[model samples]
Target: METEKKFEPRIVAMLCNWCSYAGADLAGVSRLQYPPNIRVIRVMCSGTVSPHHIVHAFQRGADGVLIAGCHIGDCHYIRGNYMTIKRAKFMEGLLNFAGYSPERLRLEWISAAEGVKFAEVVREFTEKIRTLGPAPSFEASPRLATAVL
Candidate 1:
């Protein structure tokens, strides 16, 4: 028999406090099901998520990163989500420039009331990262771990 492939992708998701974080919490309270591959880090606002955080996740062997925030104009800290949107695009471009597939990073907006949508987004993003395979950035930069630590 041929060797079977194990494709359990490790994802690090950064969620905003006001909306996306509440949405994820609702998903948990409602017993909505989704992939177990995701590990969430809650932030006061998605805008506070810096590119260094994404880079650190990759260095730590995360296969993908997902940034979730409030919907446009729905930021708890007025214009925070707008900053998040802009930072996400910049990070996407930076990933491409660093020889990594931008697909491994996802940006989404989910309101507190959309528990189902939160579950769906996690499931879909997990699937997409699984298909993309493990991130090459880690392999390409063996020294990243040493530097990060």
Candidate 2:
């Protein structure tokens, strides 16, 4: 007899150095709990995360992608996150157009002081990704999401 292992999503998180990365660090020092499934990439600003990076992560076995940065009006680089937001929308639409679920992508505004929130966001997103199952690139058929409909 064998027990089946549960699905654990592999998440790639891109965190802005000034705010979201600090928040994640705070979560660690504060002892807040989050899933270990995320592989984090530190960026100077979220605006630098182009759509190519998001698609590349998916192609490279990431089941979900998270981009976190400073909240509106709080960006250290002065409106960098505003560019992030615009790119996020475009990326989401691109995901949908490419026959993948847009829900696999997430954007959050996590200030350096919001460690608890960072942990919570990771936990929640992991659960969502788990529910969504593996990334399409991992599927044997590479079935288009639209095919299910």
The best candidate by lDDT is: 2
Per-residue alpha-carbon lDDT of candidate 2 for residues 43-146, written as tens digits (9 for 90 to 100): 99999998889988998889999999999999998999999999999888988997899999999999999999999999999999989998877354636566
- How far residue 53's Cα lies from its native spot in candidate 2, in Å, is 0.7
**Tens digit of lDDT per residue, candidate 1, span 1-149?**
89988889999999999999999999999999999999999999999999899989998889999999989988999898888888889989988998889898899999999999999999999989878887875565658868877
In angstroms, the error of model 1 at 44 is 0.5
| Displacement of the residue 3 alpha carbon in candidate 1, Å | 6.8
Off by over 4 Å in 1: 1-5, 139-149
lDDT of 1 at 121: 96
TM-score of each: 0.89, 0.90
